[model samples]
Target: MSSSLIFTFIFTLCLLSSCFSSSASLHNATDENVTLRPQHEIQKLKLIREHLQKINKPTVKTIQDPKHGHWWLQFGSGTLVGYWPVSLFTHLMEHGNMVQFGGEIVNTKPGGSHTSTQMGSGHFAGEGFGKASYFRNLEMVDWDNTLIPTANLRVLADHPNCYDIRGGVNRVWGNYFYYGGPGKNSKCP
Candidate 1:
């Protein structure tokens, strides 16, 4: 396996271990036959598990309930990254419907000219595996509360000449995609 992939797996395992260990410590039987978490902790780990299952259900439409707050984690390291809370938009009665993956950048050049910028590895998707930027083992949570390979995945490139994306699946990578390119190329400009 690639070093980067091994590192990612180790990092993810560490984060999950930490989360589980902390939450598990809070689970204890009380004399009154009720196990309760601290008041400061509004939503415990159970809530997170329930939310994950609920969101994956086909009948469920909302992604988040404002009543139960949510945070996105940027786990760069054990301490460097933190949780970022999201505020609901006015139009979103309950939560968001669409989820997007990938990168976006604006062309600030005047006269509709392309800028000499690079996206992921500074190579086009056509450059193939090791030469291009890619994402691998992509999966989505299912109603069964288990992770499943992404289905009906879509790929799009606003400026194909400047940047592009190609999707594929394999036993090793599962649902994977190679993307990105050098901007302001002869074909792009």
Candidate 2:
């Protein structure tokens, strides 16, 4: 419903996906019968238990709605994490008035000085392609729930010196944008 809630959901989903993938990669056994050392196995089990404990359990509950559909989030491994009824969002009942796709950063340091943290690719958007961070084949779901290309899209970057955004459309990428930069540079500071 609220933007902050939606952001939190997305942030949690990203964290879960990364954590699951990283933990799964710990299994190096090539064969089903491969056995690890006793100590190694214990350590692995402990690590997995800790990881599981750190994960936030989905707070969603099944709410049957014959009229409106539900929204779902899934992991990259094709695991269904959770689902919530669309009715929970008052603004999204009929259609969404606005949509946004971008990245953000937090200055962890206490002082006023900005931290030297990279936003996306650690390169300005003007660098393009392999050098800069980008989003491609952008599309939006209309009121009819049909996917359509974004139109009249406006790009905005808060701290242009620290991070910038550039939007474009091309035959290959369709509606795409290049963004992000190295933070805490001379110009940025």
Candidate 3:
């Protein structure tokens, strides 16, 4: 056979052999005994629904901003907190969302200043109040180049009191908070 034809044949054989080896390995590693538990799945679904309901359906209306995608839960005369990306805020406003009761997002700075610093949570430790354990900012563009928003929820396994939830445009700039346990504020460390 010509050198070029021989080389092509060898390459094709190598590719087919690799594919078969991968398939065989995958098949061999399959766990036939593993079964999904329906009860556990249902319980998880129920928990999620409960969480959603707490934050969404309230006796009052949720606040929304027309210019920027910031949402807030209003009470009495002041705004409790504002969420970026807007969708997560809307989700919290839905009936039967449990996340609504988790916490509120207080915009430390009114009128949405790009560089203004805001304080949240009644208690303060120096200047790091309301600082996110995982992220630094709320705009999705800051975390990623894309304008899309994402949400992250982390629950500490060892410490039942430690929990954090953040959602917004940038992973770096989002609303996040942690509470419960000894030295819970230092959990990010």
Question: TM-score: which candidate is best?
Answer: 2
- Which stretches in model 3 have alpha-carbon errors above 4 Å? 1-70, 73-76, 79-85, 88-93, 100-180, 183-189
lDDT of 3 at 65: 48
In model 2, the worst 10-residue window by lDDT is 57-66
Clashing pairs in 2: none
Cα lDDT, all candidates: 0.53, 0.61, 0.30
- For residues 25-141, write the lDDT of model 1, one tens digit per residue: 343322455554433333443533343333221221112223444322322222224322344244333333444456555788887889877876568899985467666667543
In candidate 2, residue 50 scores what lDDT? Answer: 48
Candidate 3 local lDDT, 68-105, one digit each (tens): 54444443235464443555444323222222213223
What are the root-mean-square deviations of the candidates from the true structure over C-alphas?
Answer: 16.0, 9.6, 25.2
For model 1, state the Cα shift of residue 164 in Å. 0.5
Report the backbone clash tally of model 2: 0
Model 1 residue-pair collision total: 0
lDDT of 2 by residue, 1-189 (tens): 353224322342234235444334443223556433323445644544443344332222122233656655553333566767786775555555566777898886667777788877578999986567666666665555455777887899988999999999878667878888999999977
